[model samples]
Target: MRNGFAKTDDLIKMFNVSPGTITNMIKQLKTEGLVIHQPYKDVKLTEKGREIAIQAVRRRRIVE
Candidate 1:
């Protein structure tokens, strides 16, 4: 989330992943300083996260 927060439930619904899977992925991202997660709250992306996301999107577009 760059401009807004994203809840795990919302991410699960969107990605069709299990809660535990999402939780672990979030934890990893947090460890990388890409995201910040709080208990029972939405996740927020850091500036580094946004930059990485944007780069990923660009790479995807190029591959496509």
Candidate 2:
């Protein structure tokens, strides 16, 4: 399994958003302490973010 972060460029492509939009979202996430980002580097999920993501997936599965 891949255990590393996705690059900012990869996320921008994945989300089909503009670079500016991604930058804004990253800033928001960082502000919320949900992610850690650096310019020209990968965006990483904080522990809080990871937990929330996992819970969201689990909830989706349960609902499905």
Best by TM-score: 1
lDDT of each: 0.91, 0.88
Stretches of model 1 off by over 4 angstroms after superposition: none
**Which candidate number maximizes lDDT?**
1
lDDT of 1 by residue, 1-64 (tens): 3356998899999899999999999999999999989978899889999899999999999999
TM-score for all models, in order of appearance? 0.91, 0.86
Worst 10-residue lDDT window for candidate 1 reads 1-10
Lowest lDDT 10-mer window, candidate 2?
1-10
lDDT of 2 by residue, 1-64 (tens): 1465878888888899999999999999999999988988788899998999899999999999
